[model samples]
Target: MSVRPLTEDQRDAMQEITNIAMGQAGSLLATLLGVFVNLSVPRINVLALSDVADAIGSMVGRNIEITAVRQSFHGYLRGEAIVIYGRDGCKELGDLMGYDEVLDRTDEIELLLDVSNILVGACLGGIIDQIKGITEAHGAGELSFSAPSLMAENVPAEVLINPDKLTWTHALLMEVNFTLEGRNFISHLCMLMPGGSIEKMRNILDEFVASF
Candidate 1:
């Protein structure tokens, strides 16, 4: 049997679910960071893998540190989950941490790592646990990064720029943003699979949403 492409209704439905997930994440961030977290409208983008590089570059800007945290979940959906934070976003997070001394360049970077780790971990942890029905199953994994220069040496993920030539083979790419202090930030992104495993995740979420 062939899996059908997501209809507009299906896409909207998924977006709503993502909104709920991000709302929970926002609440967690507010509590953890001791400042209010504001979420913008949930924007959904489906793109080619190659175009992702350019899309990231345009959104995050060039000459910025990009830190990423990844976690893999099984049962409902099986794919690499990633949360990326830009350099400015990290700096704002450091200030929120209430460091006494002015953050030097090194201190800024280190504080950003800590902020990235906690915020990304909490955001993803909440969403995955709610979707999977097992709070304990969602565990944290080590985060890694590729230098911005390496992106050119590696694959170009600029999907939005060249939508026509790009293929949408992936199931879904959900992105949400968070603005803290004066900086614009993309808080969390989830790439969900459309394979057999998707049924498990969809069914569970469907029931959860229907109940409300």
Candidate 2:
């Protein structure tokens, strides 16, 4: 399928859907941390595979050391979701999660994976629920996701979805930032759906908007 840029209406609709999903995720994090969680408004974009690295650099900074956890989802739609954090942010997050000891590489990895599971699970669950509701209203099948995995240290953003094996040349990218109040911790959560899924997603969003 040929990839096309999303229309203004489609972009807006997708952003709205993502905002709702991230809000749900943020609420879960807040409850778990016993602190207020601030979530950025979701940003939706369509870009070629080669541009993904630049896109991530713009969000997390080019010089910062980073860690990421990736989880792939399949079913009605297929894609990967990544949660990224800077080195300092990772340490702060561990501290917030009740890990006060000096963390070695192993300890840090364990903490990162735990946090990733909670945040990614909540966010993906919210997104899937929205997709199911929209698709069911239009008589379409539902979607599901696999387990989340911790990627190697400082994994490049472009590798989050392997372009060589991808069925589509472009991806629909959704990103949101999460920050904790009175702390220096911040993380970016991104979801990438194959270019092929955009048309179907747009149709569902169109019907969803018409109902609103």
For this target, which candidate reaches the highest TM-score against the unseen true structure? 2
State how far residue 112 of model 2 sits from its true place (Å): 1.7
**lDDT (Cα, tens digit) per residue for candidate 1, span 79-155:** 44555665455556666777666778666656544554554455555555455543234442322322211111112
Best by lDDT: 2
Worst 10 residues of 2 by lDDT: 155-164
lDDT of 2 by residue, 61-167 (tens): 67666788888887767888888987787778667778778788778877777777888788877776776777776665656667667764775544444556665
| Candidate 2 similarity to native, TM-score | 0.89
lDDT of each: 0.52, 0.78
Clashing pairs in 2: none
TM-score of 1: 0.61
